[model samples]
Target chain A: MGESILQLQQIRKSFDNTEVLKGIDLEAAQGEFITLLGASGCGKTTTLRIIAGLELPDSGQVILEGRDITDWEPNRRDVNTVFQNYALFPHMNVADNVGYGLKIRKVPKAEIERKVEQALRLVQLEEYGKRMPDQLSGGQKQRIAIARAVINEPKVLLLDEPLGALDLKLRRQMQLELKRLQKQLGITFIYITHDQEEAINMSDRIGVMHEGVLEQLGTPNEVYYQPRTSYVADFVGNANILHKNGETLAIRSENIRMDGESVCTLDAVVVEKSFAGGQLRILFRLADGQLLTASRYGIDNDIQPGETVKIGWDAKDAVKVIDNDKDENQR
Target chain B: MTKTKTKGNSRRRSGNIGLLIPMYVFTILFVALPILYLFLLSFLQRAQVWGVDFTFTLDNYKRILEPLYLDTFWQSLKLAFTATFFVALIGYPYGYFMARMSAVWKRRMLLLIMIPFWTSALIRLYGWIIVFRSNGVLDKILMGLHLTDQPLKLLYTYPAVVVGMVYSLLPFMILAVYSSAEKLDMSLVEASRDLGASSWTAFWTVSFRLTLPGLLSGVVLSFIPSMGLFFIADILGGNKIVLVGSVIQEQITKGRNQPFAAALSAVLMVLTSVMIRLYRKITGTSQLEGML
Candidate 1:
């Protein structure tokens, strides 16, 4: 990551007297892929919209490239958004849609045509320029939307769950393409999604949001391994929260071993066993009825549902986390 | 089991066909039969006394080409065009803005637009007479405001007829535009703005283009009816202006020339069909803008 390109300070927003974003402060390094990950209505999209100038923050400053653009109109801002529904102009064909921003700027028609062709080539849809938006499939439309936004090459690109509507396979494919495109363009990308796997796969850093608060912001490995709060731990991945001596600790399910050597060990009965892809997931019930999930690679047919198993993990691997307001995080 | 399923499917298909019987019967009797009778009557001759001669002649069609009747058609076209232009100018923004209003405000506005319809249109036109008549409510208001020196002869004129036409047909224009504008995806505008298009540009390039189908349909609804709403011309114009419908009515009742009336009606029908065909060609869609 290079020097910071965008800064959001003490941002707040409300709708109908309900405060959606409490006070969000974030900084995005130049050319960095940052994602705001949260469940629905967690204000991730609201924050993204604020950054895009689609919504005004009730109180705060949005500084872009050393300029305060808090109250600027969306058209005046040097930022673009890729909406979840891929809001393409149905009246325009793919080429015109891609060239819309340039046309608005009154760029020469020949240059616009060349840039449109280049942008189409960037999205690998060179043959779709003459096709209407309705003629393309969902994936194709999404590519056209991306092409349209990127044709202007704004300083920052904001994506609000752009892949949310696609099938799983197409979504994964888009995630890779988006990451690659962001890297190639070297534009600061502020992405939003409720999908943790997507965030982990694409983002250089992930900001985990909960209940209008950004719980944690870190790299995917740091977030998965060293979550600051129990909420982040539970939301980002499957984790077992164990309270000992008034300190909260989060251990990743994959870190828990079956009859392996470690500093800490616990004996629990196998409550259920299921196969998940290449891994075997076992749900174990502790003596006090606390359920802990453990994932291991390959087959372990010997351990039946009724059998008792020994689970252990190193103390260093169990990162200390803050006990959150919600007690339901322990499960 | 498959045999029973196929049998059930066939039964359902036959039931569906049975349900269409009344629709077919009504279309033939009310729609097709009248057009056929009008076409046949247009080719017949008018007798010296009452009704038609029953003898075939091209005289009625030829009579429509006469300068006196041609001028009536031209005046009707001009009046309808003027009324339609005013209707579109007032209605497009009215309906478009109404669609963007908060739900409560939208419902209230829609109710305000619809409340006039509960009363008869003829009654509404009569109400307009009270406002447009010389030395009446409009004159009193203008005098009270000291905008004019004396009462103006505002009633029973061409402008009064045009106003009545607009007042009566404005709702259809509003409703037509509203139905289509309501379905406009607002995010497309936002997306345009995000892509550096100003608000005006976004509206012109995105919102206006997308809602054009509805505006065109509104024009159709207002224009076609304005030409035929001769009662408005009669009550408001005081028979000073004669439209195609007024001529057709005069031929049928006062002149007792039913075949000539049929010929005039047939010509109006052809004009309406041509307009509809032009509309379909321009819009490239068969569906009219539905009511809200």
Candidate 2:
């Protein structure tokens, strides 16, 4: 692991008395692709914008390469952002858009042209430099946005859902391409996405956010399997937060096996079944009438509604998570 | 591709054409007929006893080429151009403010801009006269404040005409520019700054370029009507300067020279077209300036 190259300390922001990013503390290492994962209005984008100097924190320090830059203007900082909407200049051609930063710095014309060509080639759109943004497809616009940010070669590249507007297949393809580009450039990438699957596929670590605060920050497996709070467990995927003996336990959907050999067996009756693409999801009800859903791969035609099933999971599979929502809601 | 389908398509086409008949009739009767009549009238002679004589002549066109009338045309252009330039300068910031304001303030600002349109233009011109007349509010205020020894002539001047014209036409500029500014993708401005562009450069490259259509529309809308506001010159100008509007008015009303008035109108139309072309070229809005 590399040293921590970017640090956000107690970053706080608000708009008109409504808090957006409430004292967010984050650390990102060099050459690492980290994602800020959360739903809309959860302050993920606000945190990323603050880190890039596009926004000034209400009270905090932003140390970039060990230099405090909290009050620096966005143009004065060595960070770039790929906005959520691509934000390509509709009037300019691709080359001009990609080379805008260098041009503003008054770089030599020949060098600008060469760098623009190199940037376009990096995004696999070498022949598209002469086309206007409106003439390009949605995926193409996203690549141009990436190329525009990459051409600056900033220390940290903030991507605010660059693949958010593309089709599913195209989003998957660009995810891999972006990972490759981040590796090739060795720049720290701070990606913001609301999709859990997307963050898992492309990030070395993901920061989960909710209500203007970071809920947890860890590797994808650690975040998924060892969530620290009930909110994080619920946000990551199907969260089964069970109350046993006045203690909270979080288990993943895939861990709960049906009618198999394991520890912690419970008898429940099948209530509902759904046929998904390759998996059959069965919802079960305990004697106390609590609902539990289990998914098994392929069609298990034998299991029907009203059938009693034995569900079991190993004792080591579940993680103890604090049920903060119940406590906070009571306050 | 099939016979029955083609017949159904033809029937639908005819139905659509029938729906547009009222609009087509209105355009032909009120718009096209007047313009054609103006064109034909410019070539006919104006007789003293019987209104327009049938004899075709180029005398009306030739008379308008004289320096006396040409100077009025030039003066009108000077006023219109200056008013449009200053309007753009002032209205652009207002438009940007309106665009960036919160929803509540945007509606309030838009309502303020539209307040003047509810009043009659002639009434508004008379209101200006109250401030601009000799020893009126402006002169009285200047003397009352000991700013001037004598009541400086405030009305019957070129500046007065421009003031009235701008006051009457400023809303067009603001609304036209506001339309473009409101639809601007604000993320583009943020992206420009993030890409190492200073605030001014970001505005020039992204925000300002994207709003060119609105700016050009403002210029055209403000300018075309300023060319025809003879009433503003009539009241505020007080016969001191014979603008193109006043000259055309004099020919049609007092001089009884319909042919010369028609000829003057044609010249103004041509000039307006030329100026619009120049505006389009300078603003880089020839392709799709009116889209949004």
Model 1, residue A55: displacement in angstroms? 0.8
Q: For residues A1-331, could you state the per-residue lDDT of candidate 1 as single tens digits? A: 6999999998999999999998898999999999999999999999999998989999999999999999999999999999999999998999999999999999999999999999999999999999999999999999999999999999999998999999999999999999999989999999999999999999999999987888888999989878998888889977888776778888888888776565446778999999979998889888767788888888865799998867778777788888786453452
Across B175-268, the per-residue lDDT of candidate 2 in tens digits comes to: 8888889899888999999999989999999999889888888889888988888888878888886778888888888989899899899888
DockQ winner: 1
Clashes of 2: 0
lDDT of each: 0.91, 0.87
- How many backbone overlaps does candidate 1 show? 0
TM-score of chain B of each: 0.94, 0.89
lDDT tens digits, residue span A112-225, model 2:
999999999999999999999999999999999999998999999999988888999999999999999999999999999999999999999999999898889999998888
Candidate 2, B286: how far from true, in Å? Answer: 7.2
- Window of ten residues with lowest summed lDDT in model 2 chain B: B283-292
The TM-scores, one per candidate, come to 0.95, 0.94
